[model samples]
Target: MTQGLDIEQMLAQHIARLKASLQQASGEGSGPEEGSDAWLLLNAFVENDPQNWHTLLANFEQSGHWLAEQGGKLDVRIVALQRYIDALVAELKQILSEQPLLLVETVERLHLLQSESIQALTRGYQSVTDQCLRDKDMFSQQLEHRLLALQRINGVSNSAMDLDQTLEITAQAIAEELQVDLCSIFFYDDMQRVLTLRATNGPRPLGGMHFTQRIGEGYSGWVAEKGQSLLVHDVMASPNFASEVQAYSSDYHGLMSLPIIFFGDAERLIGVISVLSQEPRDFTREEISFVEIVAGIIAINVENGRLYEQTDEQLRRKVHELATIHRVSSVIASTLNLDEVLQMITTQAVHLSGAERSCIFELDPDRRRLHVLAHYGLNANLVGQLYINVGQCCAGRTVQTGRPSMAVDCFHTDEHCFIRSDPFISSEIHSVLCVPLKVKDKILGCLCVYSSHRHLLSAEQMQLVNLFANESAIAIENARLYEETRRGLELKSVLLRELHHRVKNNLANVAGILSLQRRRSKSSDVRHILAESVNRVQGLAATHDLLAHEDVSEARVDEVARKIVGVASTNLVPPEKHITFKVEPCGIVIPSRAVTILALIINEMVSNAIKHGLAGQSVGRVIVRGREEDGWVYVQVSDNGTGPAFNLQFGENSESSSEGLGLSLIKNLAGDLEGQFSLRREHDLTSQNGTNTTGDGPAEYTVAEVRFPLVRRSRTRE
Candidate 1:
């Protein structure tokens, strides 16, 4: 419309400058059109009549108000419009140079037009701002409607380990969240082809455990059958809704059902979740999607809850089984009494096998018959009398086949376990389960437990019985082995005692023969040699006699010392010698092999003390003390007599001399004791433990001490 100026270009510039947020807030489909904002500004100049200029500005106000609100300054659009007007004026001035008055009027009108357009833009600015503010409030409300999905999931996950509780909690939470009148969870049984209402937020339409419908029979069932969601505004209007199926299901007007699908399982449907409203209601896409999400969460958590329950139950069962086995193992290890242990085994097997009465049978020596070794709840008179041939009855078959066997309805069925029907019928024995009591490859016997009622055992229960059966077999074998070993030990002890007695008698005869030779001798040297030899032989006899008396391979060191001293007093001491002997024991016990050597050592020491140390002394005292310390055994023999006339080192021996021969024997005996021997004269000899002692040693006492390693022996048992 003007020279050197494109009106549409100037309008396009201002349109590009419009606020993007304002366009976005109004939505892409809404906002200024091709002939709005800058287009309205150009309309004021495009209209020919000056009277309609304000009216055109009013039109601009209708479309350009949002632009006016966006750019409050209006500097860019105003400058563009002014430049177009200046370019138009220059062209006009050139044309109207010959008419000064008209040109002046045109300039004044252009200035007035600019002022009116600015005023129009200002009015539209304030009005559109108020409208945008109200629109902002409305848009914000829509954005806040999406629920916190994490909060919802956490609310349902609190009781997810418990399946029933999870269902109920999910139903209630979803109902409250969606603001529905009722929310119900229905579990679909593929085998039964039915949908069962397992949990509900409100009162159930039917009695609990009775609310069920075949798949595709009702609105909820249809969703499960299709594995798709269903949203019905009116439950009665639903084509799949069958009122006849359940009269109370139609109480709700609106219903929305979603298939709870296990996503991990290729979208397999697990159940159906339904929310019902008492009044007709419309569901938005957002609401439907949220409900779908809740259904999916329910599907996943339900699976987890079932798995958790199964695992927990298995763990509890394992703990119980282990505890029971431990108790049985303890009892087997605790006693060797065959009857007592068998009774305990039968009791445990009866309880474990889920039966009332139990019996343990043993294979007879002939291996053709099974006899009741121990039993619970059976006739006491029938224990040994009740016998069954191999491969005949339950217990017998178990032994014959070396496996577990069960006889069901034993009394009524063709296979009968009881020999006398009267006792079996009276006891109500209808079923019996028998398993072989075998250890390794050896079958000891069989264990039979019967129930009063017809009973069937599970595989897990049978395995438990098998475990107890193995333990019982071990017990039986252990008891038998222990009995055999005990009898063997008794026989060996008797033989040993007799051998010891015979040995003692033989030695006594030898000593008597030596005494006869000594009396028949005409030489004092021969009598002394004979006397020492007799005392040595008598000491050995005394030691063996003590072993035979105690019936053990070991004897107390003090007892051996006392016996040796008694022998020495009788053989070496004269009645007028008035020598006193005292024995003190520190409760030290040495093996029989060591005791023999110990006896010899004591005999030599005492003989030496009587013959040489206490020589020519009318009154003297001989003390034998046993002591133990730091893994060593000590035997100190002291006497208040004359000390050795000639010094004899323990390591050196002069066997040609009588006293030296005795010292040599003692040295060799100490070597056999795995010990050392020392002889000394002490001024004071007080017994360490005060077993038997005087105030002090009034004179010098000859002390002989022999020590060996101490060893503590433990009895062998299980």
Candidate 2:
């Protein structure tokens, strides 16, 4: 019995030390206090038997009631003590029944042990209350730190312009705020299905390191692929931590990878933010929540920066395009030559479009082929040999459809492939921009720009090229018209010079024939008739002389009429008659054929008026007037002198009452013109006030008028 009692004492002491050690580890208290209910219950159980069990159990119940009253509720430490007391009572009852002698000797010590058990219970409850207060304070501090880090992250995200810089700043902030060893940001490349390490701040001393991982292959990639957050306490033990991450950095023991999901219905996963710790750590709920919030902020800022870059680039391109258009417009406006204009267009296209070479293809309508008219930055031989059938290649297709076409990365793409198989050139061209040169609905040709490097032209660049193509078409058409006009003018000038030469030679022959006739005649009347005929021929020759000096395609009727009237007046009008010859200004121009006929008609009329009407007068006035009105040309020759009162002749077959050669010639010439001839008496010329009369007492005057349809050989002249 004595040995058994000693064993129980040793066991009770070991149990008390174990409880105290557990309480200290749990941050409760070092041990139960003296005189507490927990200390009393422990001592009574260690020393008492079944006779004292009932009393000890009663004392334990009373101590639990007192702790509940003092501590407000049943704490974990009090509950554990109550369970221990119930087990102690059951053991003590078993000992009394099995070993009656052992309980008989320990029963007298129960009163002393009860006080120590109650003291232990009270101390355990107090330790539990203090631990609860410490935990609450720690949680509050963690929450406050998380909120401050979130504010700093938001500030960095909102003010950053550059995406890479923003990412670096975000990574550094996260690492410093969370007290992490490493913070890495991985951007997901959707096309490649990979995550590229974009930014990182860590102790590994990575310098100029580029790392990428396929989705579902590594720690960061798995988060992006799954679109979930993963908290790995022990990277080596976690099955999700891939071997690649193990190989990348063996220094990290803890990892938290969260997917950066964009805010949308699809919730697109853009990337992953990984926070790593050098020592093993179980991340708190607050830390994980903070990381997720920062990831959302980083995703939004990245997308915004990308959109800003795109918009800014578009604006810059627009400015450049406008300037290019202005320059091309200046070039188009300054020139009328076709070749020079095409050359300028090709050069500007290559420079402005960032193309390696450019060519302007002109369509041959008859051949139905596109021929290179001008080119820049290409082999001369190749350009000379380059031609494509309509609807065959890039340029040809643009012409056939009258729309723009582009081939990006032509070497790899089969659709709308560029012409790289040509034998004349071995240059590897990768992209092409072909725009049709169209005016109205007519496609003149196509302008093609090529690049040796593979790249796609933006919509703005494409639109600018199309606009330039339209301008080029207009300029080309204008040049073509100018060339045609110049050629026509040159041909017309040659014909007019030839006609004048022939007319001069023919008039000289006629004058020679009249001179011969005049010299052979014996009678004075015959000689006078031959001389008058020679004067008519000389009048016609003088009209041709005026036309030959003026480099014009046709002669003016008024100018011819003046020359003819001057010749007639000088030869036929007597100086003693004081005849003043006047010719009114006219704005009528006729072909060379019409001028000869008009000269002969005017010559006969003026000679007849001078010789017949002013034959017996000492003073006379002969006036010739030519005018065109209402599609008819009228010429009037009048003299204020006595003349024959001849009737008007209306037809070619009508005969004259007088047998004079001048009247017969005048009638025949009028018939040749398909015109009407009339003779009438004219009153003396008078001013508006009737003060400037040519002669007194209504001087007898004869007026000869010829009228003919005004014919236009070409464009009408004013």
Candidate 3:
């Protein structure tokens, strides 16, 4: 017995050391802080027979269960327990070192305990996880039920506005669809925990169609209290679930009650729904599901009706918002002048956003800085002078991120819109709202609004501002494009005028060179050829001269015809012959390409009439007439001198007459004009295959006429 007492003392000391080690590892003080979970766990192992291994293990069964219930890191606590076991085994080995057999047995028992403890820990962890999965499935089931309820409500659209009318309709529909003798709808007041009958179908209840009672008083109230469905196939014979049969009547015997629950953060007992039969009936799983779905639908519809009644002010505010945005779009679209449109946008920004001041900054070409294009409520001087670098000020930050931003007590206090320093345009300007102006993916600029007082700007107002900003960005882009196009057109006009002047000068220089060569030549044939070349060159110069003076693209045909006639009279008409020239250009103009060719043709025609027709005449009459007929421009040069060798029909010139280089040139030029040329006598009347007969009559007058299809045209006046 003395030896036994000594062994018990040794065991107690060993147990005490084990407990102390566990407590230290678990970060607990040694002064019996038994309130902690680790200490409680230690006590579970300690409050057992110290010498009897089986008894101690029996008390500490499922060590992992204890740890799991303690509710801390399972792996960490298991590690601590492992360390304690190691230490306890070493101490026990030292305490029983003299008894080799006992020492081996004690070590075996400790090893067995560790193994059992590890297995128990695994099992307990799995058990906790299984319980969590079960809870998740239960939540999913509740969610599915609520969704089915919502679907049922969706099917029952066109509900009445009045809650009483809506409940009556629901009760009638459920009764007819389910073929029940009685269907009752109960409305619940969560705060009062009371159930009130609102509507019923079929026979009336003992309490009548509308009655109120505490939540747990009757069958419907009992469903409200329990928050569960209760089905009584035989209401009178059922045990203890309900205080009394609901709607007690001879017409109905079977009863089924369901809680009208709103499954939100927590299940809320909204009301109850009941269905009854004339005979005893058992509710099937599918039938109960259907009824529960209908009950959920009733709960949602009632709640939504209440919500609908409370949102009149919100709907009114929404209408006002639509009008405001409409006003903004109209105001922004009113102008295409970039500067004026910016001004309008800034002004509208101030009005729509309720801000004290607003400004719009345009992103510069290099994308380094923003130049203020327009401003409102702020100093007008800042409009063109203010500049902010990208990522510098509130607007700059918006540009950097290409997003909408707002700051209360901005510039410094607010981190999102803060800059390195403040411009301090106004002491009243405490809040800022900045939004980026985006067109597709390109960031054109940013718009910034300032308020004098510090106040939180609602997201709705910010969104309103953003909407305007997008429209304003498009307006600005369109205006900028217009400005660019206008400038481009002006520049192009200047360039075209310059080109015509240069061409005129070049043609005049060529004419001057030809005139000099004519003076240097001794041969009369070369001189005559050079003189005609000078006249032709000068004719083209005349047309360009007219085009250069006017901003018009083509030259007046009358002007061109008169210029060529003057050149021909000055250089081609014989000195001895008293010659007269007249040009009648009946109000017409030709485009530049056609004008050049027409000038050369007229020069050749007049030269031919002078050199061949009026070769020996002492006094002569020459006339040039232009007219439009049958979609053709006709220029006729007439003279009393002899006609050319060619007749009205090409290659039909009488062999008796001579065909010179002048007449041949005229024929080729007419072809270039896509036209026809004719040499005919004034007295020749009859036409034979468009040719005149070689009569003894040398015609009294000669007429050289050319006709071309009129393709190009310009202003009739120069």
* Strongest candidate by TM-score: 1
* Candidate 2 lDDT (Cα, 0 to 1): 0.69
How large is the C-alpha RMSD of every model relative to the true structure? 27.5, 34.3, 32.9
Screening candidate 1 with a backbone cut-off below 3 angstroms (N, C-alpha, C), the clashing residue pairs are none
For residues 466-558, could you state the per-residue lDDT of candidate 3 as single tens digits?
A: 766775676666556556657787654454444455445545655675577568665565567667767766766676666667644566656
Instruction: Between candidates 1 and 2, name the one with more favorable TM-score.
Output: 1
TM-score of 2: 0.42
List per-prediction Cα lDDT, in the order shown: 0.70, 0.69, 0.67
Question: What tens-digit string does per-residue lDDT give for candidate 2 at 88-171?
Answer: 444454545665655544443443453445454455555566666788898788778878878877887887346778778888
What is candidate 3's local distance difference test score?
0.67
Q: Give me the displacement of residue 215 in model 2, in angstroms.
A: 7.0
